[model samples]
Target: MSKSEALGAVREVRLSGGTIRYRERGDGPPVVFVHGVLVNGDIWRNVVPVVADAGFRCITPDWPLGGHEVPVPEADLTPPGVAGMIGDFLERLDLRDVTLVANDTGGALTQIFVASQPERVSQVVLTPSDCFDRFFPPMFAYLSAIGRMPGAIWLLAQTIRVRALHRLPNVLGFAAKHGVPAEVVKSYAASLQRNRAIRADLGRFLRGVDKRHTLAAANKLAAFDRPVLLAWAEEDKLFPMELPRRLAAILPDATIETVGDSYTFVPEDQPRWLAERVVEFVRKHATT
Candidate 1:
C-alpha cells in the first residue's frame, strides 16, 4: 500500500488564518504529532497507525508550508508568526489537555508553546530540535552560514536534492540504524525537494531564531512545571544527543528517554517503539 494509504484516513481542517492538514483516529484523549523541519505531517504515517490502534485520537497536522502545499500568508509564516499560528490552531479547535509529540523543528516549537502557554499543554515528548543559539553538531554553522550568503539558497536549490541526502547513512546515522524505508525517505525528500511552501517556511523559521528567543526558551524550560519527555536519538547526525541531555537538565520536570537507533526522524526509524513509548508517557503524565 502507498504511504498515504498506510495512513488509513485523513481530513483537512482550516483555521481562521491558516490551514491544518491532520488525520484523526483512535478512541481516547488527543495526541498530536508535530514533525521536524522541511517535513510535512505525513512523516508520521508509519507511526500514527500504531498510535491510533493504541486507543488515542492521533492528530497529526501538516504544518503550515511544511506539507500539503498549504498557503501561509507571508506575515503569519514567520517564526514568531508560525508560533502564534500554532497557538491559534489549538485555541481555535479548543484542543485542551493535549499531548504534543514533536521532533526536530517541531520539537523546538513545542518548547516555545509550553513556555508561552503552559496551561494549554498537558504532556510533551521531543526528539532532536534546536534549543540554544548554535546549531546542533556544530556542523550546521557552516550550512546556516551558507544558507545566509547572497544567492546561497538558490545555489543550494540548484545543487542539492534534499531527498537524496536522506539516504546517506553518514548524513543521519540513526536513520540508517533503524532502517528507514525507501518510500518514507522518498516522501520526505519529495516534500523538501519540490515544495515551495516549505522553502518559504524554512527561511522564516531559521531567521526567526534570534539570540533572545533561544535564551528565553532555554530559561523557560528550566522553570516549566509540566511533565516533559526528552527522547534523544544517539545516532542523530544533525542534533547530537548532548542537546537533549542539556534539555533534560533544564526542564524542571523532565525525564530523558534515549533511543539509540534513530535519527531526528524518530518515527521513520522506530515507529512502533516510539509510538508505544509516547502512548505510555502520555497515559502516565497527562493528568499532571
Candidate 2:
C-alpha cells in the first residue's frame, strides 16, 4: 500500500490533558512513533508504512510539543508531567506490550515515561535524541531562554515562514540532512504559528525542559531491564554517538546500531533503514 493509504485515517482519544490526534495502520504488535518539538507524526510518514506492512500496528501521534492541532490548556506541561501524559495515553488506549519509537525531544520524554511506567511497554527503539545533560543540546538551548520571554514564542513561530530559514542550524538544518519537504515543514509549523493556545502549550513545555528530568530517568534506567534498541545516526550533529553509548552502558539490555548517511532525523533521511531495523529488533525480541 502507498504511504497515505497505509496510514489510513486520523483518529482521536480523549485524555486528562484533552484530546490527542493520531494515526494507525496494520495489525499485530503495537509500535507507536513519538516526534520532537515543532513536528508531528508526519515526520514518520515514510517509516510508518514499512513498519506497519511488517505486520505490526503502527501508531503515530501528533504530540502536543508544538505541532499539534489540539491544545491541552489545563494539562501539566512539565518534563515529568508530559511523561505522565505519555503514560496516560498508553493506558487510555489500553495498549500493552507496546514498542515505543522516539526521536528528538520525544526520546527524552520516552526515557522518563519508561522509567516511571514500564508496566505496559515491552521494549523501545530510540533514535537520535536528548539524554543526560544534552537535553536541548547546545545549539537549541536558546529555546529555553526564548520560552522564558512573553512574546518570544510568537516571534519564533513567525520565523518558520521563511523557507530559507528552515536550513539554518537553529531551524531544521541539523535535524534532517537532506532538508525537510516544504509541505512537511508547513505541517510542523502551522499550529504553532497560527494558534495562540498551541503556542501557549509549546511555551509551557519548552520552559519546563531541564536536564534534571533526563538525569533522574537515567538513574532509574538500570532497573528498566527491558530490551532497548538505540538506532543512532552516525553523522548526527545534534545528538552524537556518545549519548547513545552512555545509554548503552546504563540500560542492562541495550544495543546500538549506527545509521549511516543521516543526521538526527533518521526517519526523514533513512526511513527504510530505520523501518528495517525496527522490524528486526521487534521481531528478535518478540515475547511468546
Candidate 3:
C-alpha cells in the first residue's frame, strides 16, 4: 500500500486556536511525530508505519510550519505559542505519557513543549534539530530576516520552485544527504506556494525564531528529568555533533546515539534506522 494508505484515513481535531489534520496508524502507547519548517508529517511517513506496526499509535499531524495544507491565522505562531499549541493538541486528544518524536525545527519547538509542559509527555526522541544558540544555525539564519520583510515569504514560496535552487545550502541541499524525491519536494512546497494564509503563518513563526526561546527552554530542561534520546545524524551539515553533545549535558536523563550516513533529515535519509531506534527507546523506557 502507499504511504498515505498505510497511514490510514486523514482525520481532523479542533484545538483552541484552529483545526489540525492528521494521520494515525496502529495502537498502543501514543507516538506523536513533529516535523520542521517547509515540511509536514510526510517527513515521518516512512518511519511512522514501522513504529506503528511494532505496537505504537503514531499520530503524524501537518503542523502549521509553512508546508501544512490548513492555515491557523488566529493561532499564535511564536515559539512558545507553537509549543503551547502542542500542549493543546495533547489535552484535546487526552493523550498521556506521549512519546514525542521531533526533527529539524520541530525539535526546537519540542524542546519548548517538553520544557514548559512536562506533565503529559513521558519521553522524547529528538532527531537532528535546532538547539542552544544555533536555533536557525548560521546558514539559514536569513530566514528570520526574510520573515520580517513584507513580501519576502511570497518570494521564497516562488523561489523554491526552481529545481536548481533545491541544492543550495540555504535550501534543501543540506536537508537530506542523498536528496529528496521530486514529488515529495513538490508536496512540501505546495501549501506555501499557493496558500497566502500559510505563508502568513510561516512568516509570523519565522519572525519569532529568536535564540532566546531555545535558550530559555534549555534552562528549564534540567527540571524535565524525562528520558530524552538525541538521535543525531553523524554527517549533518547544518547542526553539528556538538549540538547534541551540549543537549546531552544539559538534559538530566539524556543520551546520544549517532545515525550514520545521514544529514539533518534523518527521517528522509535513514528512516529504518531511526524507526528502530525510536521503537527500542520507547520500549526500553516504557512507563507505567
Rank the candidate models, highest lDDT first.
2, 3, 1
- Worst ten in a row by lDDT for model 2: 1-10
lDDT of 1 at 109: 71
Over 162-255, each residue of candidate 2 has an lDDT whose tens digit, in order, gives: 9989999889999999999988888888888889999999999999999999999999999999999999999999998999999999999999
Which pairs of residues collide in candidate 1? none
lDDT of each: 0.67, 0.91, 0.90
By how many angstroms RMSD does model 1 differ from the true structure? 3.2
User: TM-score per candidate, in order?
Assistant: 0.84, 0.97, 0.97
Worst 10 residues of 1 by lDDT: 134-143
**Cα lDDT of model 3 by residue, 121-184, tens digit:** 9999999999889889899999999999999999999998898888887898898987888778
**How does model 3 score by TM-score?**
0.97
RMSD of each: 3.2, 2.0, 1.8
Error of 1 at 62 (Å): 1.3
Q: Which regions of candidate 3 deviate over 4 angstroms?
A: 1-3
* lDDT tens per residue, model 1, 32-99: 77776545676777788887887788777777633445555554654456666677777877788888
